[model samples]
Target chain A: MLFLKRYLPLVICGFTGVVFGIQYYVPHKASEDLLTFINDWMIIIFGFSMILALASLFHVHYQKIRRRQSGWGFSLIVFIAIIVTVIIGIISQGETVDEKGLTSFGWIYTNMLVPLSGTMFSILAFFIASAAFRAFRARTLDAFLLLFAAIIIMFGRVPAGEYLWSKIWGAEFPLQMGDITEWIMGVLNMAARRGILLGVALGAIATSLKIIFGIERAYLGEKE
Target chain B: MRSIFHLLIFLLIEGQAFSQELTPPKELKAFDAPYDSGNVLYLTWKGMPYDSEKVDYIVYISESEEGPFFEIGRFKSNTHFKADKNWPAWAWKRTTEYHYFEISSFIKEGKEIPLENGKTYFLKLLVTDGIKQVKSNVVSAFPKGNLFNLLKLNNLIYMIIFSVIILWFIARAKKRELFLRKIPALEAIEEAIGRSTEMGRPIYFLTGRLGMSSVSTIASTIILGEVAKKVATYGTEIKVPHTDPIVMSVCQEITKQAYISAGRPDAYREDSNFFITEDQFSYTAAVDGLMVREKPAACFYMGYYYAESLLLSEVGASIGAIQIAGTDAEHQLPFFVTTCDYTLIGEELYAASAYLSKNPVLMGTLRGQDVGKGFLMGAVFIGTGLATLGTITGAMQIVSFVLDWFKGF
Candidate 1:
């Protein structure tokens, strides 16, 4: 049981990882075939995982409704939505739109799901405003710099900044808000982003190597 | 069929009306394109006749020239140099003038038939001056699947070096104790968990919306294992709302194992880790609802996030939850920083598992990653210095040549 549960999985993980890692260097047809085979396996695995997701969704809501929890009504609504969507989805061949045009499933998706998801996404604009109100506060030196950069970016992103700059400065001034904004974004921002990217890339490589070598078994529900 | 019949009639009339002649392109050659997939080959021809205003070239491909051939594509006479293919200068040698076209596949009736490895393909280039047509001599080349791509050799070398550094550190760690600097945010996790226990409110953990495929998510789950163990130790409730089923399943096992480790196995509820909808905004909305309703004493947001990072954190903040956010997603960092009490910026998220676990293997990997970052920082500084020096000394070509060696595949 121990071997079957732990050692076997780890061995498979290490072997498969090494193969895929080497695949990055080899452009041979055999390597390409390996990639395709692995990708197909991942797709199959994802399909099975989706079943678990559906079951989990049902379980959570079912328990919620059974206990008459705070959002019992919402849980009931979830159950209804899942059932209805599933039926329509399977009947419609799971396509939002077919050659014949929008089916009942497509209509529900277009009308209900799209608008709901869109409305949820649209809430981020308000969230950003509130967050920005807090973030851009000039409480400290870092905050002040952020505020200054934000102000410049906000102004210079529009055409009026250039027009106002040329008008107010009367063509003698060497610097423009637009140019400063560009410098901040292109040079300063790029430098910071690249630094973060470097760290992230290195960390990613380390993490992948650790996992591939079975030194990091946290993903397998073992040591961190 | 009808179009060909009409073209035949039209060409017969045009042939009588004009006497301008066309010649085959000079110095035609077909060869395997270097530093590319085995499926593609380059066809180059010199000196397209400039005597006519309306000249068109057509490319054809076949197994053999004796029988059928199909037009793959057509293009007007234009300068297509070998240098323009965008293969790095180190790999591509012939920068001289020639009209070049990359032919990877033969198309017929909207279907592509890519060159199979080890299969010889015959190709022809035809030129027409809108009056007469001429065909170039058939050229043949066989595609060979390159056993190795030398362009990525530098990357492979760097990876091997980094792995060696990590392995060396791992071996060293087993022999001696290693010190890790205190991360205040990680320190505050215990305090936050204690608060949740005292308040009798559950702590909420979000693994973001990404799946296990993402590095950030993997890191998040590892951190979750540590967090779960800590939660078990403190007897604080931990509810993890997930976006990926595989991640949720893994988290379930991790949490259970943590509980077992802490001698509180019976207290570990399977429902502690639950799957939320995979839809981005939907999951965000659901988490927000949970935060608002449950009024969790603390919220731990870890892993990759998009726009919803702010939405969830803002709600958590509004509920007075001690929100700690960690993600490698740089763009979302500002949002997380604004709304959360503590934010793990960039690679700090990756280091969190090692920092929390204090396990030698993970700690060694983290140290090695730090060393790798140090090397990168030095490289960047040196590259910048060399570039500035080159600008001053007018030795930019040498600097650029050195820099191109570091550029990726």
Candidate 2:
């Protein structure tokens, strides 16, 4: 039974994998229907997964409250928040974000969640500036080049340089400062991007080939 | 002085007679070359009555109006004749300046009519039969410099620079000197796992939303394998909470392999690697709960990540665990940079596995990437120079041709 359970999922996966692989080449209605059925099954599975996660959340917190853990009061608050939202959601006929019900869920999402999330994201700006300061130090040849390129880009992107100097000697040369910046971005930056993309592409192709060929069979959970 | 006075008197009489007999063609204009070679001058004139049957028209070109008109070419019938096209390619390489061209038609079997250089030419056509021909009215035009020349020059410089960089990188990688710099986030895997073991708290490895196929996720998995080995060797527990089911399974094998490699096959726990929800927010919530409940000593977030980067990082931070994160997504880099103790940015995420393993093949690939980067830098230098020079000289035909070739892709 253990062996069957271990191998059965692999076999089932292999069969389905081949079917899906062949579907890519086949243009028949039956193949299309099969793909649609698979998609529908995926949606059903996703729905069940969400339900399972919610149940798990409720169980964990319910136990926490019952056992009266150190943060049990916070768990109770979360429980109350979730219960109230669900009840309001159902009673308002799924009008969770409707203007009539805006004072409740809308206020929570807008005032609490959105600002919290935005604040979390905005914290990165300071971090990036600090990282840049540390990372862009000219400790080595490569670091020097990186720092130079970054500074050029920063100067080139803004309009202040042109206003500061309109001419070099007698000739007009306002946009000359951006020349190096453009070159770095258009050439050096693009090449690095292409190299990364190529490696990623090859890795993706290899992994997909492995999956389609049934050489990889890890998605199935533990055997009975 | 006496002969000049007689000639002037005779020219005045002839000019008066010529003006009274023939009306000049109206709206005569010269346009710059439309395409291809730049030296061609376009001449348009209001057609005279006798233009249709005119078999031969005499066109004279000269540098000045005073005298010495040279016959550059003769148009047998057509109204338009390009000076550059008619002349040898090399001859038209001189400076672009103003020149003059005039046309006049002859009467068959009539005395050869000489056209004077000083007078403005009118639209004149020769009505010719086998036996006879007549002159039509004359026309005039003035020419100017062609302007679309510089765009071509800029393009050439760009192409050369781009090609040079790409080639340079490829060559350098081939020569085997492209050792990419070390990334710390990748280097800390074993240390993080060992720390977890000493602390007696399980290590938590979360491959972000990216599936197994993602480059970041693959790098993460490779690192995970190495970390798992250390955990197994130390008889330490580790849990891989995966957002992707596919990645979860990969993690399970990786964990299993680590245990086997560490000579602790019996210590491997399959349930330790399990799929949490795939939805971004839900996954974050679940992982947050796990962090709170399990209080893992170390957390690694390496893969594609988004807004949840902070939520996860902050939760892990609150637990007082050491955290290391790496990703290539530009938007998410900032989050990892701020929140994680060590974060790999952009290409470093892709370079992590090779850096950690130091396998020759992976190292070779990294070397290849450096070669590509070098080639790019060289191209940038040359392209900028050519474009700048082309602008200064205002001679852009060659540059434009080069640019057109570069833009072929």
Candidate 3:
């Protein structure tokens, strides 16, 4: 049990990491075959872990309902939702879950998940307005610059900004609002983004090194 | 009988057309393909003639140079053939032994025959016009691996340099003192915890809608540990809702450990860190509801987020919460920057946890990363100067060479 809990995971991680790391340099048939086999093994392990996750979820909800705790009604609703969906899904499919086929599973997914996801996404518009109101305040020089940039970008995205600019400075005016916005987004924004991406990439590489060397073991939980 | 007589007449005319003068492909050669197993034989011939449409070229393989040969495929007038796919097991048996191949041209009506199993052979080419057939000279070459791949030599050198630099910095950091610039957001963690403790409101930390395997999520979890320790010390409640069960488990463990280390194990609650549904929108909705109801004083959004970044941060701001957000998700950065009081852009999220915890391993890795960034900045400066000079002086050869070298990466 001790070995399984501690050394086995470390051994597996080290072995797989080394093998896959070296696999990149070797474009041989054996390396390709091993990659395929390991990928399949990963899929199987992921499936088992998913089952464990479901069990944990069910256990948590069951405890909440049994204790009749705060929001116990919501827990009952969750149980009902799961049960109805599962039963309908099983009955519609007879056994298998065919994603493309017009079964109850597909209907439930398309009707429920897709719209709910879109609604959550659409809710972002209101949030954006609220957030913009807070962020666009001209309190300092940096804040004023951010506010100016935000206004220019907002104006440039719509046709009214270009129209207003042309009316004020004539049609022959250089650098319309749209042009300024494009330059800001394309050049200045892109440059800053690239710098951030570079730093992030370096951090990721360093973290990977830490993991490979067993220097970072926080994910293994509390140090015994 | 009348139909058969008409078919005979048609065949006689076709036979006459097939017997017309047509030249054979020249400069026939066969060699093993480079950077591949010995199974593949690459064959090439001279260009097609004007009358190539009237003839069909067939590829044949045999074990022996004797009479028997098997047709592998037929083409109109291809000058080269990659004989890798659709070969027999014996042909691609992963051996250094060579096999024979023949390129033959015949009338379109020529029947393809299978070869008999036998001994060793070589390559041959046969050209036939309905009645007569001519055989060309044979050629063969064995496939083998080279000791080194010269193409990827530059890449190998770069990898070694990078590895050495990273290792050297890590070793130095483990032994020697290291300096890291202070991140304001990380420093504000204590302030956020203190505010929640004063207001008697819970602290809500979102680990993003990602699993534990994600590096960003790992950073968030580490940050969570630090925050939990402070909260435990202050006896302030903290709620962590996770979309992934594995992450929830890890967060629960980290929170428990934090409380234990803070000597507030009695105040720690297991129910505080719990799993929400795996569904992204459902998880978001649940968290939104929790925010509206509980109205946490301090909200920390950490890890990789998608569309939900704005929704969560905006809601937190609406409740007048002191929101601190950190993520490597560049697209969502603008949203977090707009909503949160303090936002850690990209790698700052990773560095924040390291800075807060003062974990030697993390600090060393972070310092190594800074070293890498410094090296890159220097290289970029040099490269830019060279490019600008090359462009201005109309001498781009050096610049191009350097660019090609970098492109090898």
| Highest DockQ scorer | 1
> What is candidate 3's TM-score for chain A?
0.89
lDDT of 3 by residue, A64-143 (tens): 79998667788788889989998987788653346566677777777887898899989988888877887778999988
* Full-model lDDT for every candidate: 0.84, 0.59, 0.73
Residue A3 CA error for candidate 2 (Å)?
Answer: 5.1
Q: Please, what are the lDDT tens digits per residue for candidate 2 over residues B1-409?
A: 9999999999998886554333333444544333222334444444443333334444443334542444434554334433323332322321222222333322323444433323343232333433454543333433233323332443435433533443454445446644566567777777787788889998888877875446568667767776777788888898887676656656777788778877899999856777555656656776787799879989988788887887788778778898998776656665566567888766665555556655443445454445445654565567767677788988565654433332321
Q: Of the pair 1 and 2, which is ahead by lDDT?
A: 1
Candidate 2, superposed: residue stretches over 4 Å from native: A2-4, A25-33, A59-73, A97-107, A165-171, A217-224, B1-188, B199-202, B211-229, B237-297, B307-409
DockQ of 3: 0.34
- Candidate 3, B50-130: lDDT as tens digits: 224445556655555663565565544332233323232222222212223433321223764322212223555565544
Error of model 1, residue A203, in angstroms: 0.4
Candidate 2 residue B161 Cα shift, in angstroms, is: 32
The top-ranked prediction according to lDDT is 1
Please list the residue runs of candidate 1 whose C-alpha ends up more than 4 Å from where it truly belongs after superposition: A90-95, A98-101, A171-174, B1-28, B34-37, B44-60, B67-78, B97-99, B107-113, B124-136, B385-400
**Over the full model, what C-alpha lDDT does candidate 2 score relative to the true structure?**
0.59
